[model samples]
Target: MQWIHNYQLFLFDFDGLLVNTEEIHYLAYKTMCANRGINFNWDFETYCRIAHYKSEGLSQKIYAEFPELYAVEPSWEVLYGEKKKAIIELVSNGAVQLMPGVSSLLSALQKANIPRSVVTHSPVELVSAIRSQHSILNTIPYWITREQYSHPKPNSECYLKAIQLLAKPEDKVIGFEDTPRGLTALLGTKAKAVLVCQIEYPEIPAFIERGVIYIKSLDDLANTQL
Candidate 1:
């Protein structure tokens, strides 16, 4: 808990950490694949491997794994467009929901006047939809989305950009992430990383071995000094 007090800025990953959009995303992907006559049987275990990547990266992974499908329909742009449409429809219909403890944590941070931002690979349109549904965006000063960054998670560019924008020392920043890629990106810099185990990741020990802290939810931060 003392460690949480050492940081001046807090960074959060969007999808599974701040909001439970992973399931929605999975559904969208499944629908898109089905529309194209491709069998999308990715379990949670398989999805976790490419979950943190950008839309293009996820498309490339899918294409690599199923070349036959890709050969039949090789346009990643088309697939991504379909996925985005599905997500937008879902969000518009009030299907997406914020994660547990996110609202309280944001309120606490607001009360403490601690600077916070969301660093995510989600595109602006998707982010905008979520913002429309949640009041938390008003509390966040900066949003480092995929549109702003050339490189995504596990590349360190987004995190480094966030550090630069926050104008805080790396040691003064702490990050909350739900995926290994996001954790790796945060740890690559001087910022301490906390893994919010929203998804089923079996590689917790490896993350701890790399000096990242692991927590089950944002509610756990309530016990800290803040």
Candidate 2:
């Protein structure tokens, strides 16, 4: 596809965009809360809304809804630690699965010899645990995990770092993200932002207006006019 030539360096968000860990993360959250006898009522859609968009408000909302959680664990980090335990347990049996088109897209990128890296807020432990299951993931040239960046998603600092290291003056770039929070980071960079998700989030129109593109899956690049 001609569109493949539009970018030289490619940046990707690692969780939901490259793999199906979003659902796994949600399951892990629910499991951790359930273990504490806390009822996490958010369905997948609600989880997407908060986790993908207004993540900054997540701690406040949870603390307000479940004071017991706040009393036992004051910081979300403590709760996330529990969640991490659940994630490791759940994926222990090699449960991690690639998102649709992930294999083909990654292989294609490798074949083209285009430099691509994963930029993720996930810790190296989890990213490695899940990614190690898939051999195709090893093809990624670089990985920027949570420990590598000061500011998280919705802040362009991480993506900018990837760009600074991998990009060249004459080469264009494409950054892939599946969440609004992650996509926001790419929008501020020189790379063209590509949202990779099936959800029809209300903010899609606005993101499109701002010049971000959408594809249900990377395989759609075959038909996309981009």
lDDT per residue for candidate 1 within 99-200, as digits (tens), equals 888887787777777888899989988898889889876688789889999987788999888888885453478888988878888888778788887565
- Which residue pairs show collisions in model 2? none
Candidate RMSDs in Å, in order, are 2.8, 1.6
Candidate 2: tens digits of C-alpha lDDT, residues 85-139: 9999988877678888888888888888889999999989888887778899999
* TM-score for each candidate, following the candidate numbering: 0.86, 0.93
What is the lDDT of every predicted structure here? 0.81, 0.86
> Which portions of model 1 show Cα errors greater than 4 Å?
1-5, 53-57, 64-68, 200-202, 222-226
Report residue 7 deviation for candidate 1 (angstroms): 2.4
